[model samples]
Target: MGLRRLDIDRAALLTALTARDEGLLGTWLDLRDGTLRALVEPDDEAFEARLESESDHYVKVPLFTREFRLMAEFVEQVDDDELAVRLDQALAGPSAFRAWEGVLAADPSEQRHWRAHRESALEQWAASWLAGIGLTAPWTDEVPAPEVPALLALVMDGPVRRALGSDAEAHTTYVRACRDLCELLREPFPSRRVRSASRFARGPVVIERSGRDVTIRLRADDEAG
Candidate 1:
């Protein structure tokens, strides 16, 4: 008998994994990339064992941590090397980097989280760092739309520009701002049909029929136009 191919919802799993209080099983399932299916479900023991195995696999793979650690190290080293430079630059001008001198100081816990849980910590730190920089208000507080530009500018100068290359800051900020605004404007999920242009062109259309004589109309491209 042939082995059945594993089928799982990658998007759903990813969404679940990205949640603030995501469970280990969901994260593990996401890391597995739908190759392994959950049988017994998630618990601390299962989570720890899976996490350990995954961590071991990550170590062996090297690809997983190579770029992540390299970026993290680069940020850490750059922050250190440019500490004086940043201080001087801030002092000389009205740069946001210099403005938050007190907050720029590192927190060991956040650093540790960044090292251990790279993606989650990076996102959390992005928000926290923005808040710390006085760009936006506290995470718990209401964030005004006016604060977005300055907050985005701070992010652009800081990690977004540093880690992802210089050209991406504006684009990243725009995309994130759109997502944030969308969430703020609507419920978590809404029943809305989002159609892609390509799909809309190629997808099917439904036609309803009644018991009476039906009149069908099919128009050609030139006539329609």
Candidate 2:
């Protein structure tokens, strides 16, 4: 199967991402097949199978827990500095991002700073990702001014504004926008050769991909936990 190129539309993705809640975006990527199925109907086997298939579809190389976890964190913590720091620690220690929830909840100043840091980081993260996919003008201050003067105009002042607005339906619009962004980000791996669900159990798997070369560097049995 041919590897799927990262070819999602730049405008649509930026729009969706900008309009969505950062927390929900994180939750979406962090969802496992079991949790995802529960988000819909847990008792439905067909639905569970489909959700599993969907994860495999976007990630064709059969990422071990290591790789999958990293990818999930990249998407989820794209805006979260505190979680990003903890995620790095989690790579080598027992402490994970979840360990910070109680601490941050108890400290309002830390929580505010954390939120501010995330927003700042998100601006950079979004710009970097857009540049990676070859769209450099979306977040800049300059304007082309045909339909809209600024690239972020449709995003910041449009759907995102409505999402953050005080209207009764604002929350619904915000949720829909967030879900759209999550789906786009989770759009299946481009390869047709979807691996079996069993491969997910094979850890400590190390994965590296450049172009179409996706390699799984398996660890020794002792380290595969």
**What is the lDDT of every predicted structure here?**
0.33, 0.36
Candidate 1 TM-score over all chains jointly: 0.19
Could you give candidate 2's per-residue lDDT for residues 46-79 as a string of tens digits?
6445657765432111111123243344535345
Per-residue lDDT of candidate 1, residues 182-210 (tens digit): 33222121113211111111101111122
On the 0 to 100 scale, the lDDT of residue 76 in model 2 is 56
C-alpha lDDT of residue 204 in model 2: 32
Model 1 scores a C-alpha lDDT of 0.33
- Give TM per candidate: 0.19, 0.28
Alpha carbon deviation, residue 184, candidate 1 (Å): 15
